[model samples]
Target: MAIKFLFFPFTHMNKSQLKTVLAFFPACHYLSMNRDFKHDPSLQTLFETGKINPIFPLPEPLEKVEQNFGQYLAWARIHKGNKVNLKSLLKDSPYFTDDSDVTAITSQIKGEKSDKEDANADALTKEQSLLQDLLFLKMAHLCDEQNEGIDLALNDLIIGHDTLIASLRGCQSLVSHVKDKKTIARKDLGEMMPGQRIRAWARSLSAMGALEPQGGTPLFITTSEAVFGYLEASCKDLVNALDIHKIKVHENECENKNEWQHLFCTWLMRAVQGDGIRENDMPVVDDRCSLLGQVKLALFSGNGINKIFNCSDKQIPVCLIKLK
Candidate 1:
């Protein structure tokens, strides 16, 4: 019988030597010993189950793995003919076999160059076509501008009408609040609102000479001619939309001075209604039969004037009457 002796040696080891020994063992051995189990239990379970496999085989040296990746990148660059130092890359890499392999890579690179040149030529042609289209658009814009001056005038008229309507609405709201039985007079309606801001903007138009001030009144008003001209010039669509027979100017009510004053007040009441001016809390203006005295008064008094009107200047109109 041959005697067999098993030589077991336990020696004091440095950190690196201990690490090498640990690296040689299976991961489970380290977990059992409580030596190197930094990974999560779930991850260890997955590793044990092989659900998530490693990209490469283990025992791979980090440097060699990095070098292998560099070789792959070099090969990719050569295959694509991307600008790179091919000679330096081939210096130490063994994967690139021989001169013939390099020659094949160069041939592929030349073909890619030809393809790129063709693509660039096609791009140039498309760019030139786009440039021509842009030039045509520029010329067309010039022609459109020359032909559309009257359109701008009509737009101005519409804008003026909108401004006047907005101002009238503001006045209506202020007056409505004052008339409300629960509302306090000077306290609530004392200051300006956003509507008043719109009204203030009329002053800018007056400064531009687009509007003028009435002689006795502070409200800068636009003339009927100016309003009509703007409407005819810029807002032909609006004018065309209205029935011509329905159009009426109530200026004839001003007989002398006092009658004219009454007529103006009456016209204002009518204009306010026509302008779609309303306060949310206020009662709607009533319509009476033509034979009724109040109805006749309203008609003759110009209570429902509908034609668009504007101030010539930025002047605030004072409210003299509280219409119920």
Candidate 2:
């Protein structure tokens, strides 16, 4: 199987390999539009006026995906100022591909006539998933920069809300934990559970809604699968305590003992009825109503032959909660 072009999490891919992969639609859009961007008088004016600023000659070898992606957004913002245009560029390639060409590419990749229909479906799913990952990474970059970032402000223009900025403030501590380690691990779990980090995130959502009412609950996205796994493991206890089978969505409807299970909501709900008493009369979460709950967990995947999300040493565990 020819898997070279797939680029899973992409930590190992060299510069030439990345350049080869990015020669396609979505990535190519910026590279084509911003050819010699320094020559553009309008963009140069924006730079002079303290409007658009992007790190050019992006960190030689360009190993980190965000370094290049940040540059892409910078070019797009300078050229396309409209929210509609920016969001479209963020989600899809401005240059359109015809159906015949797309079909041919899909057929070549899958290399089987009988699997043509399945291949098309799978390819679309993977493409959409990739776009989603990109979106999350961009947001994570904004969250990391917090007070110093303008990407979230630009995103507010696209999404029509400043909730992400406020929400970032609430989860800044948790974000820092991952940033310090560069991955998720058992210690991260310790910090999350004992500190009631999940509850804090839920409260952040609640505050966002109260401060600026919006259509839906904004998700607290993270690259920490360890955090997700901790919540997933608690699904059984939450199921028993809350007496809601639907709380944990199983892979199958039948009573399969070994079926994979995941939480419907990554937010932690108080399984018990009342707030715990405090020794020193500390503040407690008012749990009269359900807090708006949502979270998206992005994870890294590598072939069994390739080690991922961990160091070569067996004992000294390092953080692996990285953006793909």
By lDDT, who's the top model here?
Answer: 2
lDDT digits (tens) for residues 125-165 of candidate 2: 53333332333333333333342234435533533333345
List TM-score per model, in order: 0.15, 0.21
**Per-residue CA lDDT of candidate 1, range 79-185, in tens?**
56634565556566675553124433343223233454445545555333322222222222233333344444555565556556756787756454443322211
Candidate lDDT scores, in order, read: 0.28, 0.29
Tell me the lDDT of candidate 2.
0.29
Q: After superposition, how far is residue 118 of candidate 2 from its true place, in Å?
A: 9.9
Model 1: number of backbone collisions: 15
The residue-level lDDT of candidate 2 at 259 comes to 23
Error of 2 at 152 (Å): 16
